[model samples]
Target: MTDKKQPRTPGAELPDHPKFLWDSPEPKRSYDVVIVGGGGHGLATAHYLVKNHGITNVAVVERGWLAGGNMARNTTIIRSNYLWDESAGIYEHALKLWEGLEDDLEYPILFSQRGVLNLAHTLQDVRDSRRRVEANKLNGVDAEWVDAATVKEICPLVNISADIRYPVLGATYQPRAGIAKHDYVAWGFARKAAEAGVHLIQDTEVTGFLTDGDRVTGIRTNRGDIAAGRVALAAAGHTSVLTDSLGIRVPIQSHPLQALVSELLEPVHPTVVMSNAVHVYVSQAHKGELVMGAGVDSYNGYGQRGAFHIIERQMAAAVELFPVFARAHLLRTWAGIVDVTPDASPIVGVTPYENLFLNCGWGTGGFKATPGLGEAYAHTVATGEPHPLIAPFSLDRFVTGRLVDEHGAAAVAH
Candidate 1:
């Protein structure tokens, strides 16, 4: 098949869109708030900073194209069914924003709350699921426990029969948990942020931080060093690398997380099915491809490609969970770096450096918490104080021995 290349100029008209963000690659000389990494978090931070705080003097510096990071590389899963109250507060806030993100952004994000079912195979898994479900309800997060029959009914493709190994005994069902189009989210935020006069500088890499004593004054970029009153690092997987450049260390380990899609088929999955015991989660996109993935690679590395055995194990679990998918052919596979913390929870909030904020350590659950974390992190950078919703997620928590443990809840059991 011969492919036709679309031509473009330095300042040419972008392909059809209601509004454009990055018309040119020019980076602003200075800004009040410089957000590094123009993915979902960075773009959303710019949008909220302008919309809520009226901070239009902001710039989002991206090393590559917009949303081309983990934002586009994720499985597009969105949920807030975490175990701890801290995790719930941050992620549930994101879910709330996700509920009305379409209207808020004035774009169709394809936010589908088709429910997410986490299957419990072992007794320990059942107990944890029940505890989490109850905790979710108590915390005002919608969740419940459903039997295997209900799981089968909710997701007809799931094989809940006891005849199978690691049979589904029950599931923690989050009715509002679902998926969204990840690319549209980044574009919507970028467009809105641009409309508010926030600059979206693409292909601009932040090489180092310009600091005054302990305070971060601006960023040193390949294009040119730009001054800023405050700098918010929303680089996700690359957060450590950026912070390390400034000799600011945090307990964040980067890992490679992989995901793939199956060939287009008739919709077999109506909702998300996550099996914790088996270590696989599957969701059918509107295009009929079964989007699925599992845990991160065991080793710590910056490489975006995960070990092949990870996907191999996930495929076994996929076939075991839904025999119908045994014949389904896998399509393309890709990976993105995830920054995992010691507790399997994120580290967000202010850093030791004055006027420099940190929003990393999201690990595998970052996509679901983008909107909420963006708003909270923006608030942190806006008012120079941590947002109450995310105050517990501060980096100080690690040193203070107040870790919010969510290893089972936040990992890629989806």
Candidate 2:
């Protein structure tokens, strides 16, 4: 008999009621706060704005189904270890929120603390991992340096190659880092936000923003025009389209990032393993399938479908690190667009516009940072000032040369 536990066939269509549909209707043309994205960030911002700030006049406008963008297209890796204190502190807060998300939202997010190990395959990798450990500790995060022997003890299945192109040396372990249910995160936030009086309008696309001088008045959507006192641009990949309509340019690039999953098998990976040199990472899902991902496309394109070469390179690196995956059959692959910034950090807080707020350029690291981003972006929207956690990631920093470079730590995982 076929196993009932196996995942449905690839590309299987589920009943389409539009996931997490809000009960509210769109106002004719007015809202206190109009958010231009219905992804995790936008929904979470609405949640915080109502629950924390007591500001509930919000409407999250989306062009498609809620979370049909990067929020639903991430690999769900959550970690706080970083080579800089700024990122470490903010992501640590995000992890804390994730730890309590189920209780706060009264929704099952299924956050799994499987641990995340940043593997070091060379002396430079080891040194960088050590520096990240120190930086995380200084930021009051739980991070430590684990040598090769400890790594082997923790994950015996990993290849302990000495003569390989990138020899295994050591790793940095963050016990608090792991994965969470991505769709549940979006649904939970959307549910609570909608219950709190925020209108989530999917199938409603914001085509352009209505601005008067340097201040934004409202947004013009394909559905209809909506007036607002303030607007927050939480749209990840399409941030430029909205910003450009307002005659402002942000230093962001859109790239396609791909991830794949293998057929169900006996669980092997107990922790997330990241290889900087190989530019690949792997972890086993709760369903016993191996989920793996790699860097973005080499060339910029709006196409979400990536070439086979990216997955081929990822499979090769995965097999090199964990030979057991050699026999596993690939199940399916998908890609999402990422808005990458120059320093690979996010852009939060107010932009050059008076009433237009921005929370984009998260690159590939936005999923784990959703909670903190929501909190900080909500604070910025309400008070018109950057939250202390997000102060280091202001957009002007790119122009003023105060960039928070987390490249040493973010190159692999962020």
Candidate 3:
């Protein structure tokens, strides 16, 4: 129930944390736009609101420290191999932005394109993986189906022998998929947005909305009521809590998702690997620690921690798959609240209120879609219309029965 203060890497020196990136400014009485949540998504949205839409009057309000929530907790796996076309459209756009994000932000994000392998254990897994590969190909996203032998060659640490339970049959390979320094990504966005004269308001909790006849005129924060021409909700897991006060029911359920890291070791994991059947995905950090994660908890709650049983099962599957990780020491474990939808897809676009926009239900894909969602959602909020890439992800999709169900497809469930 407690974590001891231990060294990040045994007998090795670690650098000091970077200097403060952005200023914490007081909220103004009014602005052109106000974005709730100061995590990666909200910061990215603010950046694009200035760069893409030429809207500089923006404020990103965060209750806690910026990027201290899921942005800091996720395992940092970035990929665009989803089975659905709508997912491909938005995520692939984000991946393209990720490719040039460092240059765009003028910061070092350490975005490594090491690659990713989604292992298939059963016959059905192989079939579904192959189908997803083809779907990704049709969407112009780089992907290929590889046999178990290829999986072993790509990651020698993997135990592909048939003697082990749920032996690896094959996998879906995406060479462009990789991981990045998540904290740096968030800071880069925040810094850029701040330089553009946008306000980064921290420690300001939004209690409710200031509405006039169903039009959201502004937000009521603990500090004061800040007026806005438009409001966008990028408040990930706690989005439902904000919308609930207005009686706008979104099809979202919040759950706790956990991830852990091992004590720093020599570089062994060269690429990211994931398994839906075994309920574990893993990669190695730039600092040489093995990073791993699991699925969401079954229950719905706002807590930022998960049950220990989930961690136990995650480690069991991880050891059987890698074998080399069996002796590694668990460095630390933490969790984040994720807002999931019934179809396992995101909700982005117009809301019942004319001046209000909604962007949530991204679940585990929020980190990967940060830039793309920000750009598209900024356009939607500025122009009062959905962006072409995010049109299919509108809130009305649930009523129209046009859900982009990645859960049923078992494609990139992480």
Candidate 4:
């Protein structure tokens, strides 16, 4: 916070007044809590752990640089319009957090609330969209069903005519839904957590767990063994690896989710448009580049890439939707491994292993949930109890037969 009494100008501010990251010297050998990943959720978990619970003696150990994983890789669309009450509750909470995240972090997260349009192509699609919109409203999440003409008004580039294959019959529009800068979200939390005395050790891989009986005491990292009173796994797709090492299994299959961007051009698309029928989603970044992607690769792999035919199909769908982009030069393409769960919901709660908490199974919806996920995870880690916001997503839900399946309302392909 700046002092009103102090004389300060925009360009004449004092030197070293703001630091983005804490130049952490070294691993302190032990910490009160150790977060196993340095992605958005992991860093935010540490931030809330300090800010809310006053648990400052924390360590966020990453195998690579912070947010180099799915945090930086996914399309940054944010929305909470879901079909289920449980899904709507958690995602709506995240939306509320996103509404104030920039001010809360003292940083510009570049969150643009242009809107999001989920296009409907078939009768079933229209039905599902209407049902979801009603459910979203019932759950107090803002959403509405808009006809094809309204869809055209929202995103003029979308081909909503009946002549096209999988023609748009209607759409579910959420006015508050939009995109943000992914890296800024991660770094914002990182800066805040670091400033709060959370140790962020990058390039440190966790080789194994240091356990006593069923309780995990610490972790055995490539850097060395570091002791911790408790540990939480926020390691996105890599959750499988960690659980496999612990000899327990979570029903998560990792798949490569890919996205591409076109060369910078004049702004045309004002809102995010998603077509589940065609399996393609598109949005224009603040810089005017067309940020686009379709569905995941059919095969399961951690290769962090897409099959040639899959991307080719995605491009075909994109061009079909936006014929104006047919000549747009491709700038870049990238991918990240998404951990798909049996129920398509996240698992964020206590595990069978004592003193070890699990936070994974978000699949393609993880990036949109950075803040609320972190808050719930921090509360769980601090109190050794699942926060109400995340209690329904426990691993036990798979066996208990309660699933927050939201295939109609989530992911990179929307």
Candidate 5:
């Protein structure tokens, strides 16, 4: 899967017959799989279905252009140093996949293993950080505890105070974690899936599902109806709406998470830094822009845009940590809607519906887990059984009161 060189600004208008979608008005035939949402998860699922499971009759339907959802809107941070074994293990595999995404997809995703440092500012924060490091190690992840001096050595720009509102203590470092090119990741999956004969239907929204009793027979899209043996709801923010159309209630809330990028400058920040006390995280992009992100919206909403207060607070935190950023100009800011669940982890695998699969509730961590989630989800769709990597993320957990909570470490933006 060699990545072909594309134009700098890629989206050109297609011909009367788009190469991305099916040419016919509406196919009277049925597909083996119909995946909703053309984001990372959806495209990745399509690729795995064809490449791994040998299922080629698949179509990915998106309301907007491909990868135009949270996949294009994320900060592109990839990490696996979570506070639980299940999360750490799954995401660690995701990180490994990212390491070779460029070669595997033959696409230049520009993955950089610059490392991630989760800082501690209070006693409780230090305790939690240690616990997370231990948990990550227990899960076979290389997470290490580093002191304030080591943090300074890694990122000299950080303002480590011994006596402040919340004094800086130490940090947990994960060298395997880093960042990747977000748009390239989306495009990589799209191109590979398209090459593998999966229909990438953009601007085709799934209005409702065609269900026979408890089983989903197909999907009803704005363009036309397409029958499918299995339907995967990879729609992140709109999961609730689609599930509700099928009379299924998902315990997920859509919230807006804001991120801003500063004007490109000489690269200074090397490692991803997250502060639990301030609920903020900052990293420098490959283009030298400082990307900063914070917690979700104060109130839940379907709106992707966020208030100015979130940016203001994030800027304050950035300047507090590294005063040099005070002089840096903010080039642009954007927000994405995250489908948050009670435990801040994703919900993957089968739902109450017989042939309907779910891969939503990613919150803010979906971008990193794109490959692994898609691979595992494709297995679930092909065999009608949850993969071992994603068995813990089933929808039944909410019903059985057995949630895989990662709130202690995931409270801050990843």
Candidate 6:
């Protein structure tokens, strides 16, 4: 008999969800804090605001269905192996929070800490990987520079032969890196935030801002004007749409980043794998689907779908890296709009408007930073002062020339 195993029914063993997760509330006339965008970041911010600071008069406004934006479309790979100290500080904090998030949120997020291997294919890649490993270690993150043999041992499916176009020479391994169920994480945060009296307003688009002499008083939405003492923007790629009307120019550009998944099968892949030079990252979901993604498209757009050529390149790189994925049938493919910055680092601090705080420009790294960013951002909103963790990402860095440039230093190229 053939050694191949039979395929399981698709989505048969996925996590179960509650029938009614949260209440759909109409937007109040005013709130102590109004968060634009009800995705993972927005929900997490609301959750922390109530749990940590006892500020329950919060509202999360979503233009579409809850958590249906990038939160629903990402690859879900979470890691803290960044090169810069600021990035390491924030992402490592997020990883620690992720370790206990299920207990804290009182919900199952399916966070599998199976580790991540960022492959190095060239001499420069090897050098960069080794340096990043040292940087991660200095920042108190668990990272090591593993040779080709170690990489193969960690992920046997990886192709490290010399005949390939881009052979894997080595990699930087983070033992604590992993993936999570994106939707469940979002819903868990939403449930806890809603239970604490934060309003979950869906289908309410924020059309403009209500301003009073450089201070953003509230938001003007299609539903109605909702006044707020503080407004925090967590709207991923569409942040510029609202910021432009207020004549606040943030250095961000939107692009389409796509991802796809394979048909459900028995678990074969054991850990998350990413290759920056080849521009493909792979991880097998807890439900058995092989999830894969690549860098953003060349052009800038707000579209939620990418060009066919972009998907083609991504698949080509994936198949070359893991030959077993060649026969797997593609289940679905989609994209998310990502906001990239000049320094390739997130901007998370006060804006020109006194009452408005900006937390956008995460690009492909947003989902990994959900809880960490939320805790820091919530502190910024509650007290109108930037948290110590987020103080380096202030918008003024663009002018001060102290930017945290992670253009090629990050694990993935945005």
TM-score (all chains, Cα) for each model: 0.94, 0.94, 0.95, 0.94, 0.93, 0.96
For residues 191-279, could you state the per-residue lDDT of candidate 5 as single tens digits? 88877778787777789989898889999888778899999989997999999988888889988889989998776788899987877
How much does candidate 1 score in TM-score? Answer: 0.94
Give the candidate number with the greatest lDDT: 6
* lDDT value, candidate 2, whole model: 0.83
Provide backbone clash counts, one per model. Answer: 0, 0, 0, 0, 3, 0
Which clashing pairs does model 6 show?
Answer: none
**Residues 1-414, model 3: lDDT tens digits:** 112112123234433546876788878999999999999999999999999989999999999999998899888888888889998999899989888898999886777787889999999988888999999999999999999999999999999999887899999998888888898899899999999999999999999999999899999999989999999999988998999999999989998888889998887888889988787888888888899887888888878775689889989989988998999999889889889988888999999997999999989889988888989988898899999999999999889898888894333344
Put down candidate 2 lDDT per residue, 294-407, tens digits, no spaces.
Answer: 887767766777579898998999888888789999999999988888888888888888989988888889999988889888998988888999988888997799988766
Residue range 1-414, candidate 4, lDDT tens digits: 111121111133222435545665599888999999999999989989998999999999999998998888898989899788888888889988888898899976777788889888899988888999998889988899999998888788888767988888989998888888787788789888888888999999998899999999999999999999999998988887888989978899888889888898776788888988788899888677888887777678888765677778889999988888899998888898888887788888999999899998888888888898999899999999999989999999889898888766654353
Model 1, 1-414: lDDT tens digits are: 112112121233323565454454477778999999988999999999988899999989989888998998998888888888988888898998888888899876767788889889989988989999989888898899999999888888888888888978999998888888788788888888888888888888989999899999999999889999999998887888888888888889988888888998775578888876788899887667888898888888878775668889989989999998999999888888888888888787888899999988888888888899889988999999999998988888877899888888766643
- Candidate 4: TM-score? 0.94
Estimate candidate 6's alpha-carbon lDDT, on a 0 to 1 scale: 0.89
Cα-lDDT of candidate 5: 0.83
Q: Is candidate 4 or candidate 5 better by TM-score?
A: 4
Q: Which stretches of candidate 3 lie over 4 Å from their true place?
A: 1-18, 408-413
Error of 1 at 199 (Å): 0.8
Off by over 4 Å in 5: 1-28
Worst 10 residues of 5 by lDDT: 1-10
Residue 63's C-alpha lDDT in candidate 2? 90
The alpha-carbon RMSD values of the candidates against the true structure, listed in the order shown, are: 6.6, 4.9, 5.1, 4.9, 4.6, 4.3
Candidate 2 Cα outliers beyond 4 Å, as residue runs = 1-21
